[model samples]
Target: MPRENLPEGFEFVASLPDPDGRVNMTDEIEDFYGKLDIDPVDPANISVGIYQWADPGLAYDAKITIIRLSDEEKADNAISNFKSQYDEMVARGLPIFSNATVNGHPSLQIKDVRGDNSIRYLFLWRAGSLVTLVEGNQDRNQSLELAEAAPL
Candidate 1:
């Protein structure tokens, strides 16, 4: 199905691809979904995705993860840490995006901290629980927005 056909919760995120070439949806998701591989030179190629239900509580725990490293070693370490941190957090039944790659692009996780947590929209890729985001944020809308903005 075309991207426009996808529902509001679904995100269309992908490009023509680069040196490695374009990636087919089913294959891409199926390929790295359970087992993500990391690339050094093109850290952009490593990313993570997250999908949350339309619930008030869920809005505060939806996010995506991207990793850009100079070498596979770094990516491996990141993957390891990400897994450990992700597992530790999700074990609590909190919403999260543990494994995903944004259109084969690389990115870091970032987080925000404040005194209050009420009436807040925080997509804690690793909120308060354990995994501290290294390059994402509390702006939970960005992920779905970016994905929604992508061209088919």
Candidate 2:
């Protein structure tokens, strides 16, 4: 469908940039993977529905701001009115879960980020704002990049 064909709430936004442009983050990852003798599919292909620019529709029952939270900030906020994303991960029996830390992008308030043992995919989620990205296998690298790329 044409760009204009999409409904107001359904704007088109590819996870990777268009082929005509050299801006898709996925392309960069592909290039890096090629050199490593790996394929993009090798990584867990985690993804959230809406792209960065597209309209963030009614993802959650109510709209919430995508607070660019840091690891430290998340913890600080956790003291009050914070949800325990890790608790869910633990319940799901995630074997390869990487608990969010304030190591890098210190202002990223990622609600939930973990790997699903059953599907062998990594899931990075931000609830209240409703942004979920799932990467399977080696695709988890994408989540890492996205988290790092966030304006934390």
Candidate 3:
């Protein structure tokens, strides 16, 4: 996570507990994949950082998750799994962009519209042995900006 590069008005929030400083997802593989609706991919470790906007008028929060795999191949597989899931959603007529790039890296962007008319964006991409997911209750531009600024 790049605290300094966060968009203006965003403030840091507590990170998900990781007493060991490295959490192995395999321990909770079912719950993890269940939440994301994707097949599980073994990752060496994972970390999460949460952020909120200072402006109360903005209903936006961001969760940046970084997953480190044993090698680049595993990282690629993880990203592919996510893309495949998003592709299924797209087939069902959801507003998802499967062919986007963040910082010149291939990325997937999913636009979710809430009943309250607020939108959330999810961006996923991979760099070397690391896979990064940037999800937020913000617009597409803001999501991509955060993803680009991330220090993956």
Instruction: Specify the highest-TM-score model's number.
Output: 3
**TM-score, every prediction:** 0.28, 0.29, 0.70
Model 1: CA > 4 A from native: 1-70, 98-134, 143-152
Ranking by lDDT: 3, 1, 2
Give the worst 10-residue stretch by lDDT in candidate 2. Answer: 59-68
Residue-by-residue lDDT tens digits, candidate 2, 1-152? 12333222334345333345555444333211221222222122222233222335522111111222234334234222232434465677754344553224223333334244323223344443222333222233433443333322
Clashes of each: 14, 19, 0
Worst 10 residues of 1 by lDDT: 126-135
Task: Write the number of the candidate with greater lDDT, choosing between 1 and 3.
Answer: 3
Task: Order candidates by TM-score, high to low.
Answer: 3, 2, 1
* Residue-by-residue lDDT tens digits, candidate 1, 35-117: 44433224344344444435545443333333344455544544454445456446776554434333443323322333464
Quick one: best lDDT, which candidate?
3
Q: Is candidate 1 or candidate 2 better by lDDT?
A: 1
Worst 10 residues of 3 by lDDT: 28-37
